[model samples]
Target chain A: MKYITHSLVILLSFLIWAGTAHAVEKTSGQSRLPVTESMVNQKFIFIGNLIKRSKTFKNIEAHGDEDVFEDIANVKALYKKAELSVQQGDYEVANNLLNEIVKLVTSITRKESKVTNDQTNSLRYYNERKATIIALMKTFDEITTNEQTANESLEPRRRMVDDFLNQAKSNITNGEVDGAIVNVDKAYDVAIRITIEVRDGITLIRELNFETAKDEYLYEIDRNDSHYFLLDITVKEKKPSAKMLLSIQKLREESDGMRADADNEAKSGNYEAATDILNKSTKNLIRAIRMGGNFIPG
Target chain B: MKSGYWLFILTICLSGSGIAASFAQEYDILHPPLGTEGIYDPENPGIEYLQQPSEALSLLPSSPTGNYVDWVKAMDDSLIEPRASIYGDQIMRAISMDVIMQQTGSMPYVRFPHYDHSLILSCTNCHTAIFLPKKDANPVNMYTILKGEFCGVCHGKVSFPLTDCFRCHSSVRDKRVLDE
Candidate 1:
């Protein structure tokens, strides 16, 4: 009887221990199964859709070169492997593969961004240089024609600038942006040099023909405004002496009065008188600017 | 006696298995055990664990105030390239016009260079919204600017601080008088 009791006690204890252990194991395994499976499925679908709809991916497809193409192909292959891993219930492997795909795509996008930015910069620089050269050419023509100073020496330089500009345009048509920029820069240099030489040359032969007094008045206004701007820049830069400052102040007051008189004349429809008064105002400003130790043409 | 012992053993075994199974079913991946819900899980993370601006902005050029990064310089230096549009491959067209604003006081006039702004922004960003295209339409004063109007909208908010005055008030005052 004692033996039977001992046997029954041992059997009961073993059954309890075994039952608990097996229940814990079964619960842990089953708990992870559904969640892992669903999560893997969702992530796979998400990444796949992301790749398909990504702007970077589309940009690469449209503009990617051979090396970029290879990188994108590798991304596709890794994505497929991640999909297979998800199907096989290997969530860990699938997650790692998906991460690799993301890294690869990120690197590709970064490279593409640089390429696009460089292209944009090149085109913008070319356009800016082109516009500057054209404006400089107009200034060169106006100064040469109005002053009639050293035309014999300037015409050749003018033709050279025109040739450079034409070359720049042709280079742009051929998709050589760097070449275009170089040509445009050369054209600008020549054109600006020609204008500066003519304006600075002491030949005071101003034969400007304006169709209307208002037109000449408008021109004088622009001239006065520019001189005023130059005077301001020079004073801040040069920091002239007190004596020079006093002289500048007196000149400035006179110029201001003249400017007011000119504006009144213009309002009263006496544009010719306004033009003369404005020109005098500009000459005073120029003298004051010179007192500040700066040399600018009036 | 043997039969009663067998019956007792059988009852204990059945009850022990039932209790163990029920306890196991109480916890799972979705329904975690009580008191363990707040614990960090490696498999699943919250949004707080993702990349934050504080960490990312450190990589860009640092500024004194307003914007943490010098965004315009960053773009110019090729440190960052932000897309101008989301729908297509659009680029910003830089306008190279300079507009001079006459000052009321003795301060130098403000020369607003459209090239700098238009290089990064679209015309619609400020036109018809913050400023009218027409001349003198927007009465931009320092008081209004300091109060977060006109240039202040971006200057003290995202671009740079307002304390740097010489940057905008660059054109000097012309102090010259004309001869009779």
Candidate 2:
């Protein structure tokens, strides 16, 4: 018991030291991107060492020489290390933790690619993965966040995003994003933390949607050479974002109207009028399709 | 002489315009059949070009006109460069441009408006053709036409002399056509 207590103190001290060092590095901006691959390599070793420690510790349990109290202290230390690296923008380290975290939660989530059910450690692994993903999200957030100020046209939508973000702010204060996404490794509906100001002389709306691969929305924004800016984001599962469905629905209505007009023209024997209407309606209907999705898929 | 020149000019220009319209219909190529013109607007009425010379102009019963018709309209497929669909080659063989002035150059004008460049794209603007935005459906490939053969019909014959090769090959080579 005495040996266990001493080992716990040592483990706690090491974790506190690692976290403090990471915190100091962040405020100084020394550890942000353009982050060297070597720096990632350094942390890889640390994570590997942690995994080895866990495996060895598991083995020692067979001999009854292993101390749960000391080992738990070590795990706490590892979590603290990951938290600090994540705060300092060292995501490789944080990601390494999530890899271990998945292992920690594997027994609960073994059968599914995604876990809809919440278990005890499942909650813990979810938070860790969420942190890693949030780190990835930060770079994208910076890209689309401030695009609004340049666009004066989308003032209404921008205001809505702002209001929702504020509500999210209070949630973040109360641990809303972190609490919900705790341990399951899915994209958390965290407070929309990224913020941007909309300025004048720009007229466009851009939303950062990493929901699927084929969505070249951000690439399109980058390609648009002049006179346009991005709109703020409002991420959610059911928002039917991208306004794709809405545009297709509108196009279908217009094409149907045009077809009716064409039928009327044909019935009246206005060949020229019918031809023009049919041609235009067909072109619009073709555009309503996605990359092999409709007739095709949704 | 000046009065005579004016009379000749008047005859040629008016006849050219009329013939351009009739010829377009006679061939029955791509444009709507003859006289199917839309109502002309009196105020700011657009030019009503038939897109080609009327066949009536070239059928004047004179030797030059007759020869012009023969060369521009009646080309022997054998004489045409093997599979050479050049506008100049087609026009030249079709109308026997050899009998006109009889001077053929390396490059001959087959059709008035070449479809190769945008500045000369009025023909294909609406008329569908190969590599579209092409005006004439049967485009004489510029290379064959310019080779003093096929489409060099009326263009190289009575129209613009083919010896003036600088019109098409002007930007291509350093040496301009050294001949008059």
Reported per model, the fraction of native interface contacts reproduced equals 0.04, 0.00
lDDT of 1 at A140: 56
Candidate 2: tens digits of C-alpha lDDT, residues B1-180: 679657755654554554444345455433333444344432321223322234343433222321233332222222222222344332111111011111112223222223122222221122232222111223233333434334454335554443333333332111233111
What tens-digit string does per-residue lDDT give for candidate 1 at A182-254? Answer: 8977776676567556543222211234788897787677667656766775787679999999999899899
* Standalone chain B TM-score for every prediction: 0.58, 0.20
Q: Please write out the lDDT profile of model 2 over residues A45-112, one tens digit for every residue.
A: 65555545655444434432234335445555666777677678787767676456446434322323
- Model 1: residues with Cα > 4 Å off, grouped in runs: A1-47, A55-73, A83-96, A99-125, A136-161, A173-178, A185-298, B1-167, B170-180
TM-scores of the candidates in the order shown: 0.35, 0.14
Tens digits of per-residue lDDT for model 1, B1-180 = 879867887878696867654554444333344334565553552332333344355567766544357776787788887776796565555655556665323346676776678677755467646765444467665656666789989886676765545567665444231110
